[model samples]
Target: MGRLFWKFFFFIWLAQLTTIAAVSTTFWLEHRAQEERLAQLGRNPPPSPELRPDGRPFPPGRFLRPGGPPRPGFPFVPVVPLVATLLASLIFAALLAWYFSKPIRNLRSAFEAVVNGDLAVRLGPVMGKRSDELADLGRNFDRMASHLSTLIDGQRRLLHDVSHELRSPLARLQAAIGLARQQPEKLESSLGRIERESERMDKLVGELLTLSRLEAGVMGAMDETISMDELVSDVVADARFEAEYIGRTVQYSGRGEALVKGNAELLHRALENVVRNALRHTPEGGMVALEVHLDASGNDVRFAVLDQGPGVPEKELNAIFEPFMRGESSQYNDGHGLGLAIARRVVEAHGGRIRAANRAGGGLCVEIVLPATCG
Candidate 1:
């Protein structure tokens, strides 16, 4: 900021200096010419008034020396052009200053709006040609504003979808419990299914709640910063045991500390889903690998979960992040699509990115990257 201040100040000073110099040079030249003419005429005093070529008489002071006869009783010679030139320079300086300051003023205003949380505010409709860097700046601001608006809109939609899904299951659970009293035998199995459904809904609701809090950056109770090795290792150990018991393998490696600042519980949940997502899709003979490495692109820690399962179509790569957008289902998969959505939200909260893609050897790869703190 200090640098910018001096840069503009110097520019304005230069402009004013140039204008003054040009005006002073013009005045000096005109004055020198007038003085030479006056000096030549004074050597002869114009031959006397009768020697004048015009029939009409000339002004009394027309034949006087350039600066008047250095006598005590001559009218003062007016510095009209010099004063006019100075005035002109003042006008030019004022106009140049205004032309240069207007764009800067607009930029400051837009920056203030951004600081005030009006991410949608943009420097549009700026009165200028679209050929200069300022035009590019205006366009860039507009683009940034547009992207922020889209992200906000996406979040709002995700919230609405989550709320709507949770409400329906909750209402059904309430109704099912009420009916369980009237038909004990018949409602037993129904209640069991309802109980299971209610549990699933409860889990889904909890995951969504965590995702929301992460995205909003609200502090959840019992949340604290923990070591990356501890978190990832715990999840892998627990999941690996379960996979082994289920006749599958959960191979993993997270050597070298990958530091991140976040809620341990929420991050655990996020990581759990990513690992489970791969495990669920992977075949019995197939293996799921949870690998942690430094993300070169983001200069952050990356925790990637790769699965050797049937890959998704290319068209569904990004769409899979939407809430409740589970990829095409199979009889073997009772998939609820909130896993990737929650993963994405949690990672983004830490200024990170997550993505999914098909692997070369016919499988799916999900990568989670969290921003790294420079040590």
Candidate 2:
């Protein structure tokens, strides 16, 4: 990069030098042309003595006299505009070159940062609005850096989540089988517990695989159209049934025909995860309400599932959508913490966004927004 910078800077300097040299040569040629014109007029020695054979133009005027000796040929360069314009052009070129190279310098420093392992390094303001090819290159570099950072972060999260989640199941299995060998009476219960833990691990792995497939553009082949309103309504109905089975109720309010394109099973799973997550936190008789809003153009729809339960903290709002990020409130929850993460992945696969927030009325609100298909 430094070599490139020096090469680039020298190229500009050499260009300016070449231009100035050309102008100066033109100036000198024009000067010679004027002198040649004088010669052609037979005035090469300039007007000769109108008066004396003396070296003085007139009666040798004293140096202190008011009327001086023939005022020496206006003491000027041969080609005034050429000389002035050449100097002016050189100065203008130098200044313009410096102004243009400022961004390249910033870009050089930013490259140094990236070389030194700083993924966050970005070009300075000089590069942002430049109307040249370099500006586009700088923007593209920033975008590449951004995506690399995101991919690295995602990999880190994946490693951490997978490691932690696997430990529990492996440990449980080892313990269960170990104990089953010694005590026959506890064998069945221990085996059952082992099976349960193994199922949870399988579920987590499945969700991770689904996330990977979604990122790999797997949904590009799936064909399913779902109504956003009915989608939410069905998930809420299931949650309500489960809640009532456990002595709780879910309140649902929504419009109809909020249509979208997506894999119905995946969409159902995303909504079910959200509704079930809300119901899991609330107590008996607590209410979970569903709201569906269609865009005025009906080209989009939003589903908001709100629950009257202890909402997650503000700082955890964004993190909760990330895989394995169990909020402070969910520290004791029994399930693996992939529900919201999977919900986000599914929604995003269909070109949408999902966000969690604290409702004003003391609860959590998970909003899913999806693009709708036009009739």
Candidate 3:
């Protein structure tokens, strides 16, 4: 039997049982007292009453019954009616149990399906249009399942992309090794190719590790107060050095000092990745600008990086933050396509949001918003 059925059955049964026991006990006690009184009457001799003036009995009908007084015993308790009532109660309890347990059973089944990897399972239709806690639970379960399914799908896609990415470099590395073995005289040149490929592989692995850690929330404890302005300046300075070498320009502009509490290393890396990405796309002699300022309320600090290169397509603005997701313009570049993804993870870990949008005039603008430390 279902839980509701048993619960109702037992409850109703116990109540009826208690009522019957009480009634039976009271009847038995009254019977026993009456029996004791009869025995005492049998042992005692009755004293004759004084004759009335008219020689008539004072209480004429009092002694008219056959035994001295009718012996007291159990009272009639309508056993048939009591039994019928109990049976009815039992039936009603069963019905109530079934009614309450039906929805719960449906929810359990849906949960089981989800546990078995059936993400499409939902309980909304099963729950029907009832306004109760059970119905609310069904709705919440569907929402949770939908979210979990999305995350799982994203992870699967990420794995596929990662495998595809790893294969290309591996093939090149193997070919370079084969060439070195075949041409011993040009081993040095072949080894140079091998070294470059190895370095590329190492960088890719390191970035993957970093991304994993960020996503897993494995960063070390953050206890440092970071000056956002200074951090941005440092990243911009490094980008500027590289930009100057390539005939491009990097500039930093800020209003007030923006301070926040977080891991300085992670914040720096996040900013550096964004700046470097912009520098990579910005054409030679173009400018990549970095701006930092606090919001009007001073509760949040905003960092904006704008590049003078071809911006991403309007439709793919959000896709760029996903792992291995590259825009049309970036597809032809020599990047590993994980820079923006890592930057996003880092910023999110620090309780911030990063977004990219196309600048009005030209190029792409990336923004980072972090909660500022209160003065």
Give the winner by TM-score.
3
State in Å the error of residue 44, model 2: 7.7
Model 1 residue pairs with clashes: none
TM-score of 3: 0.78
Q: In angstroms, how far off is 252's CA in candidate 3? A: 1.5
What is the alpha-carbon lDDT of model 2 when measured against the actual structure? 0.76
Candidate 1 Cα lDDT to native: 0.73
Task: State the weakest 10-residue window (summed lDDT) of model 3.
Answer: 58-67
Off by over 4 Å in 3: 1-4, 12-92
Cα RMSD, each candidate: 8.4, 6.0, 6.7
TM-score for each model: 0.62, 0.75, 0.78
Please write out the lDDT profile of model 2 over residues 1-375, one tens digit for every residue. 345445555676677668767867887687667655655665323244334455554533212123222322422344776577657766665666666666777777787887887889765354755778778778877987788789888898789878988898899899999999999899889989888988988888898887777667776544577767666767877787799887777887777677788788888998998888888777667888878888687777988888878889999999988877778766447766778888888888889999988989898999998998863
After superposing all C-alphas onto the true structure, candidate 3 shows an RMSD in angstroms of 6.7
Looking at candidate 2, what is the lDDT of residue 95?
66
Model 3 / residue 98 / CA error / Å: 2.5
lDDT: which is higher, 1 or 3? Answer: 3
Q: How many residue pairs clash in each candidate?
A: 0, 0, 0
1-375 in candidate 3: lDDT tens per residue?
676668767887788778877887888687667657767766432454434478973443222133345313234466897788778877877776776778888888888998899999988888878888988988999999999999999999989988988898899989988998898998999889988989988998999999999988998978789998788878978998899998999888899988999899988888898898898888878999988999999999999999998899988999989888777756345778899999999888888999999999999999999999963
Candidate 2 segments exceeding 4 Å error: 1-10, 28-48, 51-116, 120-151, 222-224, 295-297
